[model samples]
Target: MLFIQHLIRLLAQKRNLTLLTLGVLAIILFFGLRPKTWPNINHAEWSPDTQGLMFHAPGFAYVDDLHTLHDRASDQSFSICLAVSSAKQLPGFRPILMFHNGSDESQLTIAQWETSIIVMNGNDYSYRLKLPRISSGDILLDGKPRYLGITTGDVGTQLFDNGTLIAEKKGLRLDIPTNEKKLRLILGNSPYGNHSWEGTLHYLAIYDKQLAPEEMAASCQLNDGIDRKNPLLLFTFLEGKGTEVQDQSGNDQPLLLPSRPMALKQTFLAPPWPNFTLSKTLLADIIINFLGFIPLGAALYARLRLSEAFSRWYPARATMIISFWISLSIEMAQGWLPNRSSTLLDLVLNTLGAILGVLVIKMSWNTMENMLSHANSATDLAK
Candidate 1:
């Protein structure tokens, strides 16, 4: 009882209260500011004997300044062929390859959701034309390498697994932008560093002309499997050891294997609202975010109320406002950290937690006063 009284009395002092708040803030920063491990290049490896790029976790290699190829491929028929082996099946969409229009807008994306392969064709207006999205069945999770290929012409698009026709859609075509903007090719991860594929990349080749099923199948049989005829882009991953993957198509566009994943430069202040999905992980994140700020709210409210620095209602309001600023600052910082998402949901939850803390301290104020009084009486008696 005496120890509790002493602790409470110290917290009520202005200097001690400031120290306590700073301590709590420090703890929050420590957890939120730590760099993500999966985005590091250490998670990726080059297999010399197998001549493949193995990604133990989410990582990426990118090819930049592809304006010439982007312009030619736009409004034209094309085919893409790649061989990949899934290390483990995950629930969310994992991007294996994406083409961006020199900016955040995506021109094309080939991703894996669970064991299914999904191919989306469009520029920034993809969400409007939802159909023609090719979502294949669970075929890549068998723990063995499989060759996946796609061809898109003016009529429709077709997907092939090991050269076998699996899924095809009409009225869907490769819609690369005709603009002269620079283009980027991201392999193994999304541009935002969110969707990361865990697998081994055997080979990836891009052709200007849509190839027939026989050609696509025949290409998979060869060692490199590149069409050998003027491919727009080809990555064989045969470097064995280097920070760069040679572009065998003679495009002179090399894929750079950076030590860290790419993160958005200016989105730290204003990230788009996170898409909420119901899952255990989501539930846990909500709980952690809400409960984390409770102590700050309670301590600030208590100190403000005890010091009589503000009116009766203002202390609670002030506590909430202060909590909001703190949470927002933290969220902004998280945006720069790889793999750490800066979401409005977390900010709102943390503010609500602060409110809860304020209520808790308000309700327990009388009890704390009584305990302090008893401790004082006991101290007087001993003297």
Candidate 2:
């Protein structure tokens, strides 16, 4: 008992150590317990060497590259080798090869669920024409206006998803002839901007031979479909994810890792924070940081019971009013400081922080006050 008392006294006397420990724990709780909301106030992050442009669908095992889009308004000729199979769904995009009627679209979305591709073109034209291979069916083209038409393209006949296009009729028709140039896919409003293309690609080939079925399956299985055969896409040996286990001892299986891209070299105004270094805008910096701190600040007020004391010092109703003014003052002052924004969002969050603080004070008041009151009474009795 004597030794325990001495240890407690020593801890109490070391104010600096106690304060440091408290601050560290508060920071950990602030970050670790945070909800999964993002664009968080993470101070330091490594930037990607080069920003990658890619698409990720919700459940599909493969990623489609936008770079493969082919575009030619009576100018460029394009060729792509593809294996058509059944495992892939409808409205599926062939890796973009030879594009037309795409000048205004930001991107194309393949809607397998609705058997459509949503083209978000700017609202200028009453109608626009799209061109793609014509497959079998008395096809119904429907959208904002919901129009129907027959379209055609030089195409092959047999292919399966998850199966390779083992063969094709030599010199199949793919491109529209100059005389029948009306073989165009069209979009218009009343029934415009949104439409469906439900059909199939017979086969895509590099040479005469069709790729093997297993090869097609493996290609679609990749996230990037990056060089699916010879040297498989893999994470680094240093990385923990996507690595294969060799033995019970947990050693590496001796696979060569690809070299990473060059690191992004940036000068940080605040060391370790490349993001903070980008903008010199004082007002913007203040606003951004103010929003960043609200949740942490609210947790602090809850732990410390600032609102309860303000109520005691003034009136019960003044709690919300007083808390808001104090929080707002801090946010406004941040304008004079570097790396901050004067955003309305920050003010909103700070006010919300105060409201949350007051709520915590009201919720815990009876229990905490009772505990403290009993402790005082016991001390007096002992004295």
Candidate 3:
């Protein structure tokens, strides 16, 4: 009863402060909740000059019906060959091509980190199993087009660049998605749609049997020596006018392109666990989050201090609690927005900002009280 009365008294006496607090909160919500992209097909299109699918922005092509790529593999041996060119050197991990088991289980992924090539193969249901991965040095992002190929055979997994063997690891088994599982093939973007590769894909071919050294060399040059019967999936992207890319390998697995470019999968309220990275963007984000909440902290502290019940550390603690709840609410709401990210890091930074605000207000109040006390003492001496 006393707490409610004190809040009412504070609001009634300090209407301007109340308005300021509400106004700040409104501004934060407005900017934080904005969507990233609207539904549009112009983000991706087929280029006649490049003779391939061009991704101008973040978009993807998906293959829903998995027919003969994984189940027909000869003794778990397969080769993936593709000719692609990057727009430029980009930061962070972006998936050029990937295969998953419908849901969240990733089977195989060909991702790019800066100018390096990363091939990850495993059933990543949980973080328990250490997936086998082979990485190469800065070989991508060159001016000319490059043929990237990966062949996993009885010996090991080998990474090929422009028909030449660049990196290889012996005794590593790569698990490709089988036909028994409801698999999904995504090209040019990640399943979650957060990571998208901007590039031009000239051609892609997957063989059931691992290509021999000579065969790999021939296929990298788009020669006619490739085993016609062994190709499980192939895409030339010759249809330079439609939303669907034809599969020339004859398995009838065509890539269906969506008209509206949006996130392929939905994620909600994801915690910031192991995705931590020290980058310029991350540092900038930290600064913004910390500074954004400082005003809220100051306003809360000032409002609470007007109450007689708020004494000593009470106002400061209340300010922090209020700030935490506000941050938590915003983060939770961000999960619903496709562009916004809900992270624990942001919440922590916001709380710290509020604490700093409270400290500043506390120091100012102490200095004012000391000055008033000294003035009263001088007046008493004059009397």
TM-scores of the models, in the order given: 0.87, 0.26, 0.79
For every candidate, C-alpha RMSD to the true structure in Å: 3.7, 18.2, 5.7
**lDDT for each of the candidates?**
0.76, 0.30, 0.75
Most lDDT-accurate candidate? 1
Residue-wise C-alpha lDDT for candidate 1, range 144-228, written one tens digit per residue: 7888889999768999999999999887776654447677787777666655788888888888888889988866543753346
Clash list (residue pairs), candidate 1: none
Which of candidates 1 and 2 reaches a greater lDDT?
1
Of candidates 3 and 2, the better by TM-score: 3
Residue range 75-145, candidate 3, lDDT tens digits: 48888888888886667777788887654444688877788888876423222455568879777767457
Please give the lDDT score at residue 81 for candidate 3: 89
